[model samples]
Target: MPNLPLTLGCWDYDRVQALMDGRVRPEGIDLTFLNMVVEETFFRMLRNREFDVSEMSMSSYLVSLTKPDRPFVAIPVFPSRFFRHSCIYVNADAGIDSPADLVGKRFGCPEYQMTAPVWIRGILSDHYGVPVDGPTYVTGGEEEPNRQEKVPLDLPPNFRVERIGPTDTLAQMLADGRIDAFHTARKPSTYDGVRVKRLFPDYVEVEKAYWRDTGIFPIMHVVAIRREVYEANRWIAMNLFQAFREAQRLTYEGLKETAALKGMLPWFNAHVEETFDTMGDDFWPYGVEPNRATLDTFLRYHHEQGLSPHKLSVDDMFAPETLEEFVI
Candidate 1:
């Protein structure tokens, strides 16, 4: 029997390098790995259902479920995760000395529903006591202009989402103090230390403390399959999941080969060791079971921020094929 032909749209990550280079093919799928930045991939996938499978914004994927047009179902393959403490940039003159000061300020993000901002907003509210509904959210492009949300949202009236003018980009707005704070995945070009600064300049220590206090390593993206494709070919889910897992396994093994230092970092192995000490062996775990707390927290954030109609469980977001693996 011939293998199913599928295309996966995702960013160029070390974990999925094997898949892109044709070294680790899915068990029975001919995967054409479409390499692109996440924004393009997400915009295309959400707008047109462009690929058979793709890295989707986790927050947006949750919102998709509430829409009657249930376009996609995801496996528990997370291609991107980040500690979002460094993602918050604020105008130097905005008088936002701390998170609490951010209340009543104009906060800008690329989209009200993007995953990075969702994580940033949640973290600030939960840890810093800056209410989630406090900031008047300004939404538009970060570098370009007039960027729109991937999915249409029907948020509650209390949520204040105001759009920037067609020509206004959040990057420029933050520099000009038109928006007091900017939270997005990519750092804006205006992030000069003097004009635009991170809310926590010492974000490394702060993020470490955050992890120590709360075991939440924020997740940004998940690999999702178009519902039409998934419904017709259910077995493809596990095949792809196992393939992604194997690819990550290779990357993890590569991260430890300190014989000559595989990466550019001089003390790469030291950092890896420190990471292992802080997080466990399988630090960057990909599965519903290990990530239940993280996913559940994100679901709560999605619901609280009004991006999701209701809080969804781990089972609600992932394909059942990825929930467990057979023991040898």
Candidate 2:
């Protein structure tokens, strides 16, 4: 009997590197891992279903569920998580001194449905009183010109979203004060601090305080298998899930090693300690039950913002096999 062949597309993270290097192979599977940055992987996967398994934006996945013939089914493995406070950038001339000041200003994003912006908008609306529909949204390329939304959106009538010209870039638009603030996952090169600065200069402390208050570590990306692939081989869901979990466990072990530093940061250990102190040992958690609140909150945001028709439950987003485990 031959092992089933599969291909996975995702970013090159230390956590999932074990799988990339062939060290954490799933049982009864022959895996081919394609390591790329998130943007390309996401664009390809959403546009074409390029890989058998791929990294998907949580917001986009929710949007997909709204479609009658959705393309993918996800496991609980979140390869990427981020604090989006640092993702908000504002022009110096926009009179936006704080998050609250941005109401009625021209807010820009690469796309309204991008995961980071959804989390950012929801957090700002919930915490800072920045109304979700307060600003007129300008969407287009951030660095390059003419970028389009990977997934199409049919937002509510109240929300105002418009696109920039084919030759226009949001980085230039932001620098020119045409757009007051920008919410994005990738920081544009035009951000000189004097011109375009982060909305939260003290974002680290602010994010820590947010975590302390809310206990929600925002999940940025999830791993998904194409629906056809998943349907044909349902067992692959748990096999891949367990493989990813092992890879993440290896990552934690490597990060906690005291013998020598893994990367350039001298205070990596201190940062790790601070994370544990703040969020506990298993800070980056997987599975449905442990992440219910965060997932539910995101779903609520997705629905309210008109990306999802209804708020999807945590159980609705993940594979059933990954939802439970057998105990001794």
Candidate 3:
């Protein structure tokens, strides 16, 4: 067996390790798992060059798309519910009530430009009639100076914004009463002397409604491979995708067991279970034929938001030949 170097980035490192160890063999491929993030960081310090391997991290993956050189055979992992962002938590001591009470309250977030914050602000502006535009709304990120950007013009004018550090800081801020409320992507188990009152559930609900209304699903993330890598080692790429598919299938069937084994914190476990229950069926089929509806929805949003230089066709995002193989 030729040892293959595969890098995986996820919150549940142990679960992935178990899968690779054949404790939970999905597709019979036992590729070696490399600690890419830690290794890459260390190598970069010594040689000032990045360690080259297939890198996978949901957060970093989006930034990867903006790179001109993209991979060709990245496989889409399981689809998680869209509600993974923009939760509203309040200090247990604080008497903050509904979304309307957010006025004059300080909030913390992971990033202002992140999808969750943007979506949450949009919902508050469009649905709840929150005035996000003025000085009353305060949000901050970890980055220095805590930059704030105007909500998209299409969104409500009153959407105030700020940046905060990571989710933990946000939780802490809420707990310490430094912020009356904080908005972040929190699992159900997150507790920092504060309690999550309401997350923007409407984010997922609205996404589903949009899909039903327009047959378009929001694109949260993508699995991309560099074109060059695909040409050189198509077999490995295909095998990798098969492994991912099998893993996803196993995850779906063994949800409860996987959750326990993954040692997901209580809040995360419930959140994962709920998400799987809701979006499990919509997970893309393993074979080629990418979910046209989902991709189209994502592209449409990307185009409308001017995020992409040009609208990408289905072929632009997926390899047609690989997809054809999966078609019945």
Candidate 4:
């Protein structure tokens, strides 16, 4: 008989397609997959512990560690990794031509403690000497009028974060020049106009330089198991970890299969080759040891940005079962 059944919540990204289709399955366990938008999934999972397993925001997960009754433990399976250089947008007329100019400026954010913004701000401060608290941050939805921070923050006195009313939004304020810039995980709908432009005109080049220097790809989301579920079934950690790795392996194979262009791009194959050359063969590695630098870097940023009440190490983040993988 099967050991038990579990519900797993995540986006239907290409990386997890095999698992979603039942082509890959964890040993001794059955999974009920919940395909949902990342925003809704994260909100529900973090706020209510609504799923047995789910993908969670790295920033929010760190903050959750501060609570006396932590509800979840994460595996090192990153479902989403993105560089945030392209997330920062500035008003064309704001005189913010470079990262250094962002100091003392007014910036809008959907949430100051979101993973993308945390990585962007940390990079800005560490790489360009911009103070992490340099800008006065206004928080609200990117397009909609009503939004709020998912969790409370414990910031230093110099850090200024103001929550906006239901009638206000970051995109509208940015277009109207009420804010000098806005940073978000997704592009604002107002981005089609001339009023707002990406802070880095050549963001690709900028991002490449950053990666070359730091070797950090910046993990946005990680897979987590409900604490009670994990405690009741400790062996499930490795089973789920191996299943995710197999799913990712299938994704890599699909990307390289050149019988026809797997994606819509004309240069899909060439792009894959170039990426391998630039980022190395195992670009999207999943294990804890392979991702230690990135995990450590993000943890440091979370602590320094006051998102985490105290500094937490990488070991504090992942399950002990996930800390090592068996070698052949």
Best by lDDT: 1
lDDT string, candidate 1, 277-313, tens digits: 9988898999998899999999999999998777888
Candidate 4 minimal-lDDT segment of 10 residues? 146-155
Determine which window of 10 residues in candidate 3 has minimal summed lDDT: 42-51
Candidate 3 lDDT, tens digit per residue, 231-321?
7666655565556665666655555565254454667567667755655653435443546655554444343333444556555554444
lDDT of 2 by residue, 87-137 (tens): 999999999998889999999999999999999999999999999999999
Q: Which regions of candidate 3 deviate over 4 angstroms?
A: 1-5, 11-19, 23-30, 35-60, 71-73, 79-82, 90-107, 113-115, 118-169, 175-181, 187-196, 199-228, 255-291, 295-315, 319-322
TM-score of each: 0.98, 0.98, 0.56, 0.98
CA-RMSD of model 3: 7.4
- Cα deviation of 177 in candidate 1 (Å)? 0.8
Residue-level lDDT for 178 in candidate 2: 90
Whole-model Cα lDDT per candidate? Answer: 0.93, 0.92, 0.46, 0.90
Error of 1 at 179 (Å): 0.8
In model 1, where do residues sit more than 4 Å from their true spots?
A: none
Query: Candidate 2 clashing pairs?
Result: none
